[model samples]
Target: MALFFANGATFATWGIHIPTIRERFGLSDAALSLAMFAVAGGAILVMGRLGRQVARLGSARVSMLSGVLFALATGIILLMPSFAALLGLLVLFGIANAGFDVAMNAQAATVEAAHAHPIMSMLHGMFSLGGMAGAALGGWVLSLGVPPEMHVTAVALLTAATALLTRPLLLPDAIPIDNASTTDGQHRRMLLVLGTLAFLGLLGEGAMYDWSTIYMRDIAGAAAASASAGYAVFSGGMALARFGGDAMRKRLGAPRLLTWSAWLAFVGMLLAVALPRPWSALLGFGLMGVGAANMVPVFLVTAARLPGVAPAEAIANVARFAYVGMLLGPVIIGAVSHASNLRAGLGVIAISMGVIALCGARSIRPAPAEY
Candidate 1:
């Protein structure tokens, strides 16, 4: 949980510094989208191989090393001398962060398997809480005239220190699963479904991460001082919801829980598109945070439990597909906004959420044994 929290904080701190970087580089929306693509690309390229390594190397060691590397990469991003240098650093950041993501989740899955109840959601909740803290604190420091490099450096140090301190607590290397009969046609189909669902869930999440602040500032006419309010609201709602997600899942089950969540995000995005004011935008994003907070965790948990494939590989495949959404989300929104308007672009997101709700209902159906 501490590892997940530290990783989330590291990423969130970088997120809060984006506007400053954008201003420094004088980047257009398209240019920024391209850079975001580079980040996603790097992650996608490395994740499959990373999964195999986690299995061999033990998730704890890999997670710790990757977490430290992730922080270092994030800190260096602020010091990049040119757009190209920034892009390169972002790619490096993506690779290292992806390593941390897979390793941490692998660790969580191992812990979950050993226990009788759910814990992934709670661990993920810690991630959301870390995001909220990082964003709030980063914004506060920026307001106090701290440079982005200095702020990121502080976050990096904290992340590295926390991971190092917590290193001994993570799961140890385990024997490989012996259930060779687990993989079958049904399992393959489920893998495809889960991967698709992961894509949809993460698409919305990445969009919110990359675009919510910009939307508040540019579309909702928020003042410079208040632009980050939307992001804070979104992250806060997500944190609150994730803290409750495990209990909710135990009560409602995965299919129904995810179904409602997708609709919630849909409604939230609709509200934002319709109102387009500062407070309304914040409210809408908060609703979105609630809706999106647990979708990825649920998807990941499902992948971990799937029969046939190794847990790490299953997760990697799902992550590969899912992260495509994150990779393309910014570029798609940017292209749409460039041709039309952000409002229209976000309307597409609203509609996408509806599709996700329907698909989640079908894809997350109970296993045959449960039925």
Candidate 2:
């Protein structure tokens, strides 16, 4: 739990510094995109390797080391002498984050496997809370006239300390499952299906994060400060609903729950775009948040439980797909908006959810919730 919280907070702090980084380096939009690409590309490059390493060396050890590096990366960014060095550091940042993510989640999957009921949802809920808290605290710190460097350094040290302190608590590595009946082909097919759905699911999530506020401002005709409410409401809704997702998953099962979630997101996004009103848009985005709350968790949990596949390996494979979707989702929307209008771009979110609803429902294995 602490690791999850620290990871979220560390990532959130990096997000808080994005605008600052841009200004400090005098980067144009395209250059910034290149920087972002470096980060995403680095993560993708190492995810499979890190996943395998986590399986071999144990999640606890990898997670501890990754967490430390991940936290430090954010603090080190401001100290870089040039934009080129910063870009290189961002690549390392992505690698550390992906390592931490896969390792921690592999640990979570192991812990969840030991229990009779669900816990992954609640753990992810903590991440949402941590992100909200970290962002809010960062805003407050800026308001207080503290140096941005000081604030980031403080968060880095604290998070790194937390990671080190919690190292002893994470469960030991699980032995590899030896289900020879489950062929490599079966695992590949299952991972491919799960990866596709994860890609679609996270694409919507990334769209919401990047485009929701813009939609509120440009399409819904809101004031600049008021437009920030769009993302606030959406993330708030996600955090609140994730605590209940375990029950939802248990009662509805994966297929039905996923379908229901997709439908909710689809409808929510549709209403937001069609209405183009402030209150209505906020409400719709919030609904989409609730709908999207459990997507990655479900996909990852399913991937981890795949017979004869290492949990970390399966998770990394699926997560790589999801990461690509998230990385491109905003660009895709931006392109669509540039070609047409913001309304049409936002509509793509709805279209994405609609596709996920149709395909995600069928992709999930229909096994009982316990699996």
Candidate 3:
């Protein structure tokens, strides 16, 4: 849990410094997009292989090493000699971040197996709490006129220290499954199905994270103060929901939970797109958060438990598609909105959620595990 918190806090440091990095480098919007793409591209590049590496080396070791690298890469960006250097550092940062992500999740799966129950959602909730704290603290420091370099450096050191300090506590990773057998027909098909669900789930989540505020302000005609609340409420709902998601999964099971969650999301987003009122949009986004909260956790838990694949390897495979969806969702929404209107763009969210509900009769079936 502390590792999750450290990860979130370190990521928050990179996030809050985005505008500063832009101004410092004098980058055009196009250049900034390229830089952001570089980060995601590097993460994507590594997901396929990092899983094997984690399996070979153990998640505990990989988590510590990658966490340290991630923090250092994040801290050194402002210290880069040129724009090219910053871009290079960002790519490394992304790679390290992805490694940290897969390894830690692999660790979580190990812990969950030992407990013989569900805890993924609760661990994810800790990450959410950490993000909120980090963002608030970063915002405060920025408001007080702290230098980005200094701020990032301090957070980096703290995160690195935390990783080292907590290194002794992580559960040992699962034994590696034979790679050849995992690619057999059934496992491959299961991977594809899980990947699809992850793609759809994260597409909605990424869309909300990037566009909800704009939707609240532009379509709903909200005041500036109220507009930001759309994101705040959405994030809050997600954080809160994850804390409850374990119990929900225990009680409801994935198929029924997903069906109900999809319907909940469909209704919530429908309310927002149809009404176009500030408070209504806020309520809608909050519900969207609740609906989206458990999908990834359930999918990941299922992936790690797939019969023959190493838990780490399966997670990376699933996350690979998820990252792609998250990367494209905002762009897709933006293009659709450009062709039509913002409402139409957001309507994509509603339709996608509806698709999950409609098609889930077949696609969501998984091994009879307690995930």
Q: Cα lDDT of all candidates, in order?
A: 0.81, 0.86, 0.85
- Top-TM-score candidate index: 3
The candidate with the higher lDDT, 1 or 3, is 3
Candidate 3 lDDT over residue span 62-159, tens digit each: 99999999888977878987889888888898899899889889899899888866898988888888888889999999899998888988999988
Candidate 1 RMSD to the real structure? 3.3
lDDT of 3 at 302: 80
Error of 1 at 192 (Å): 1.9
Superposed model 3: Cα runs more than 4 Å off: 177-181
Clashing pairs in 3: none
TM-score of 1: 0.86
List candidate 2 stretches off by more than 4 Å: 177-183, 366-368
Relative to the true structure, candidate 2 reaches a TM of 0.95
Error of 2 at 107 (Å): 0.4
Q: TM-score each candidate.
A: 0.86, 0.95, 0.96
Question: Which tens-of-lDDT digit does each residue in 4-121 have in candidate 2?
Answer: 8888888888888889889998999899889888889989989767767777777889889999999899888788999989989999999999999998898998898887778888
lDDT tens digits by residue: candidate 1, 81-101? 899989988889999989889
- What TM-score number comes out for model 3? 0.96
| lDDT of the structure predicted as candidate 1 | 0.81
For lDDT, the strongest prediction is: 2
